[model samples]
Target chain A: MSASLPSTSPFPFPRFYNFPPFFSRQPTLQTHHSQLRKWSTLILNYCRHHRIFKLSLIDALDTELLYNKSLDKRMGIGEVREVVEFMRKEGRAEWAGEGGKGVGGNEVWIWWRNPEEWASLFYEWVDDTAQKHTVLTLYELTESEATISQEFHGMDPDLLQKALSILVKRGKAQVFGQEDQQGVKFF
Target chain B: MSRKGVGLAAFDRSRITSAQYASHGNSLRSSHSTSVATQLSVFRSLLQQFAQTHAKDIRSNPSFRAEFARMCAAIGVDPLASSSGAGGKDGGGSFWAQMLGGSVNDFYFELAVRVVEVCGASREENGGLIGVKEVKDRIMSTRMEGSSEITDDDILRAVNTLKPLGSSYSTLTVGPKIYIRSVPKELNIDQSAVLEAAQVLGYVTVSMLMINLKWPRARAKTAIDDLVSESMLWVDMQCAEWEYWSPGFMLGTGDDG
Candidate 1:
């Protein structure tokens, strides 16, 4: 069990991470539930620590997040996809779209911070930046030097749109854009 | 416990000395230590003769060996410990422990370890549980140096010795049969009662649980499903009746209708 993974891993892998059977889906109900729960937590924590906003099944395997090359053990793609789906059900992640990176299109958008939490953070940033009642492109909100120190900088565009939509629903911001040019004006 | 076990030394000596001489004399009371010494020699020879003559029977028959063990216990002699060159005075029984296959306790202890190993090898399927009879069969099949008269009693005795090691090994009773568990998972009362009903042919179904335990459909399913998930019982979904058999168990005690 002492066989360790790459020291570069974002999160401290659990002790059972070295157990060979750790990757195999446990057939028993209680054991299976516990395994899924632990895997889901590990996935969330890993992505959050590495500022990882998107994770497809293929990239996850190569990153040594779902597979341990040292132990020659890996969670099958299907098993990993199931864990992502479980995270989605728990509101910790969301499907990227009707598409995926790998064959099955099982790519998922990992949401380290749920939309509500991100929206509140964005609203705070806008308030502190004197951007209230001023129009700003989606790019300026996430990419500009004004928001460089923000934890949510370089956010996924889809997630940025969702965060703005939350402020829009409360009449705190308004979104207006053409087909390729999008911008939001906070009120 | 060892106190009571050693109590037989004085009692057995007095009886043997009293039986040989019918004379009522104060000398017998005065020479108590010498009388005990003479009686011990007589008793040792008698036990030695018994072991030499019954050596074959004890080796071939498990029940007879168990009886012999009981008698040894009655006289405060351990069939296993007396042979390890440990017991200083009761030395004649060392041959008995040897004749019965090199310390009965050692044989059984070895078997107990194997039983747990096999049961735990496939934890996902077996839940570290194997039938007690299956344990006996596996031990008998193994070609050990001595003591081929392996029986369920020996298995039970060896398992009892493993109890102090922790909950890793234990004997579970289901109806008239026993199952050995090499893990510490707890079995709730309802789950136990469900297994108890399964002793008839080594299996149970939801319908069987419903009828035997007089349970509602949901109640029966919950208990059976718990057992299945725990791997304490196996499910045969292909069967029309949905049989849940605990493999490597099921010694029919004729209680089944």
Candidate 2:
């Protein structure tokens, strides 16, 4: 597959995806399996290009991937699990454990674009800044820096640290305590 | 807890066909009342109406209330009333309420909930009431894809099963919707042998709507595909992957059924 970012078709995109099965997961083994592959590829490709960090599975029910009106039929827990389990099998997703029993009620964290991508983002972000040698707290890495921009929006608080920690573990950046509870600075 | 069903006694799945005049021919022959003959006459007339109006589409058509009443009278109340209805203020409304209210068995409840939530193409110019033609059209449209092989008859049959469950054949209204009233509070099909086939079968192969009712997954993916091709669960096509959001799911399989 040529990964050079398929030709940037025209605006408003083609509305051809209105087919019913396009919304429903095929019940057949081969079809469902293929459906999963297509979904995962699309999800992963989008995240990689845009650098999306954490994705809540609940967020999957949007107009972007699924138009709300078309959902005339919603996904049941078992169906959602089948897809999530598929994602989990690959290192692409994890259960956030914030909701009720099973992964159905819980939020799923998609690592389709994992912390490694974030680490790369952090490096690029740091490289573009004039404050290369300057130290800043974790909070600043998230918000205060001009380089962070909108990319940090929705990144989980815990996950944000994990992403930063990856950078720390790699010796690309150093994190040390400064003043009190908020005393984290990346150098 | 007994998982409630009409059993083969209430209605046999394999027996009924489009040309069959009496759904309860054997039961009618057994009854020795003169009224039984009259009832058969009425049953024949209703069946004729059903065949004329729907042909094979009889399944989703409104339950023939007159025939159902006769069947109730024939089978006696203990069987029909006990499992099916709740003693209530209104006759039709109460039974309808019970059907819509809730069930103890996790299986059927799963199915009911899915039906309530399923949204298909907007067909009704007059609100959500999908015309029989529209419903058939949607199913037929999918067939051209060369993937799903389900026929309109299969969908109609599945919908017919919901007749007793409360689907307004004419206007798809809001209030007084039908729901499953009697599922076992603690019956475990996973532990039984007779129902083991249905129990182990994947949710897809079980009747389209029935698949939601504590049905098992299919033995293989091919079976599930066949179920879809048959249109047993077209309304549920999109979310074939997800399960319900139940507190019962919180517990493990070993928990009380």
Best by DockQ: 2
TM-score against native, each model: 0.42, 0.36
lDDT of 2 at A28: 45
**Candidate 1 lDDT for residue B194:** 81
Taken over the whole model, the C-alpha lDDT of each candidate is 0.69, 0.43
Chain A TM-score for each of the predictions: 0.83, 0.68
List fnat per candidate, in order.
0.08, 0.12
lDDT of 1 by residue, A76-144 (tens): 888887787788779887777653333346567777788889899988878887888888888888888
Q: How do the candidates score on chain B by TM-score?
A: 0.62, 0.20
Which candidate's lDDT is highest?
1
lDDT tens readout by residue for model 1, B1-257: 55553575888888878876645455666588788878877887787677778767665678888998789889887665555444533455555454544445455567667766656553544566667776666556564767566778777777776665655778888667688877787788888888778666567888887777889999888988887788666554433576776644422221111
Question: In candidate 1, residue A22 scores what lDDT?
Answer: 51
Interface RMSD over true interface Cα atoms for each candidate: 15.1, 15.9
Runs of candidate 1 with Cα error greater than 4 angstroms are: A1-187, B1-45, B52-64, B73-106, B141-149, B163-167, B239-242, B249-257
